[model samples]
Target: MNFSFLSPVANAVLSHNELLSMQALGRKLRIHSVEEGIPDLTGVSVALIGVLENRNSVDYIGEEYDLNEVRKAFYALYPGSWNVTIADLGDIEKGESVEDTYFALKTTVSILIEKKIIPIIIGGSQDLTYPIYRAYDNVMPMVNIVNVDAKFDLGDSAKPIKNNSFIGKIILDEPYNLFNYAAIGYQTYFNSQEEIDLMERLYFEAYRLGEVSNDITIVEPVMRDANIVSVDLGVLKASEVSLKQRLSPNGLDGKEICAVSRYAGISNKVSAFGIFDYKPSYDDEMTEMLLAQMIWYFIEGFNYRVKDDDFVTGNNHQKYITLAESHELVFYKSIKTGRWWIEIPFLANVNNKLKKHTLLPCTHKDYLDACNNQIPDRWYKAFQKNSVY
Candidate 1:
């Protein structure tokens, strides 16, 4: 209800009605405007919110940029066979200070999640990911972030937060809600040896671009385990997003990245999603269309979400318990969707944020490895993190 920080979409753009075709999402989406107030989100499944605070973006340019083109491209696309309702809540105008923008974003995102509405954020800079993480501080104490980028973005936390160094701020900041952080499509050349070493020392996960591009399905389990997914467009290859000023030559291609977005949407646990580092270019139809398709895939995947959160339903999942190296590993497979999860046991004497039986999304291969007397690395890392919390 506190949308005072928001600016509605431009009327001239909406008047075009490119999204008014039958079965298109634009026909169903409730658009906010100066003439009409915010939409009634009673049955809405996802809310699209745009932010216009790229001042903190390192090496910022193009002072006047908005999600207009992205919206136009997205609205023109037809919706899948989905029963989900979506709303475009318009853009959050840049505040007096960058911190003010963070405040507005955090408040807006947190309120949406409280209403069980997943917010799809189109952001100004990747640093906004910090506020997106903060939005879940009170709602879910233990947070896991999956970032799709070519760089680790783990700049020195001692310095001011920028688009490149915000992750460091999240890890070193107070409240310490972050339980695990995973960087997918990270190019080794882009990150320092020390940063990569730090990731291992802290039990944080990082997947090289090669590892995922080799097999995109491998990332489904990782995304399935995540709560907040932040994607930086800098990870895309130059050919995928030709208009970007500093596009990388070697990175995930358009199809691979869209697959990652779909995986994030399909996750039952993933609550907040963001695509950042988008700098709209003049007459760049490819960039706009690609971004729109990425969003469309995410929404399409969300419609296929399964109820695998509660294994106690008894009839919904098949439970498997395996003991290896004096440790008990429990795995569950959904009878309906065939998705898998591995349970990490909690310390009986310790008071932790995790429950007695905490399930982490995993692969069928993990269960096979456990049966072969080999412990899956994922279960080990998750168990270790849960123990500390």
Candidate 2:
């Protein structure tokens, strides 16, 4: 069904020129003109999606960057990045009860996955992941998901599906457990002590703010394992994000945020990458520009991954890759149980079947681990020099 996209709403959203210019700089995909518009994503590979407008949800950023802007910007620059598409949340509002919206988004995201189109989700709240995750979780038994945020989003919030609790909800409600979960750059206040306890008990993978380094020691593996990646604007430091429904005083800075964004884009598992909590009510061009830059870097990384990450078949199992370029290969597979994953790694120099017939050294004494477990990357430690997350 075609939802009514009001003119006022359209005005609030970023104009095509703003996004197309970004495309011109990268110039991956070209459309007729900003006004003439882009193709209908006939053969797109990556999907940019978001709940553009919502009332009960936080509106600090307002709806300036709706799902359409996300779609236009990415497609303009990265043509065929998204074949399947859905614009806006269809009159969804925060205070209004709209469980149906969640279900619809879930179905749409699933469709994108089945089509092999990586999803880029820009959001109204962290809860937006509910439908996106539901869609992804249904088709893929095991998927690696990463959240770069300042809070755990433990499902205890003012609203059932507010930005904060959505990830918590997905983890608790999924039919089969996720492959692995990493919550990065969390602030102490957004979460309760009890929630932190639960996170520790669950052994969810995590990296405190200080733990992140340019070398990418903590985050690379998270990207390595994930089939899809997610980012919440709240994860970024206040200086980095001018607009946020709920702002964080302390978190990841601009450079770190950009690095993580690139890592997610490049990894390629990125069936769907979602960014939430950018409230335009507080946005300045500087912050929007930062957001725009982050988006560009992410698309560039995705371009590298998609152009490069071809799958490999093994005797035991077929391997699917996320980011298999720039010297290292990363892919994930499920073990006997639906809950766990086994990562098969190789130097990019090797062929796709590197894990199939060849033997590689286990970088970590314990190769298989839970989210919180830290496994040293031998490739990085011994060869790459500086470690990267």
How many clashes in each candidate?
0, 36
Off by over 4 Å in 2: 1-38, 53-96, 157-159, 213-215, 243-246, 306-389
Using TM-score as the measure, which candidate wins? 1
lDDT of 1 at 260: 95
lDDT of 1 by residue, 285-345 (tens): 8878888999998998899998776766699999899987788888999888888989877
Candidate 2: Cα lDDT at 365: 23
lDDT of 2 by residue, 1-389 (tens): 22222122233344553545543432343222335333355566654444653433544334444444344334344433532232222222232344766765676677667877676666665677666777866576655567788777776644466666766667667374464567877766777899888766655666777667434545654675566677777777666554433376677777887778877776646667877766654335555555666776676667656322222444333343333224334333333211112343444663332233122122122233222244334333323211111
TM-score of each: 0.96, 0.66
Give RMSD to native, each candidate: 1.7, 10.1
| Cα error, candidate 1, residue 183 (Å) | 1.0
Alpha-carbon lDDT of model 1: 0.87
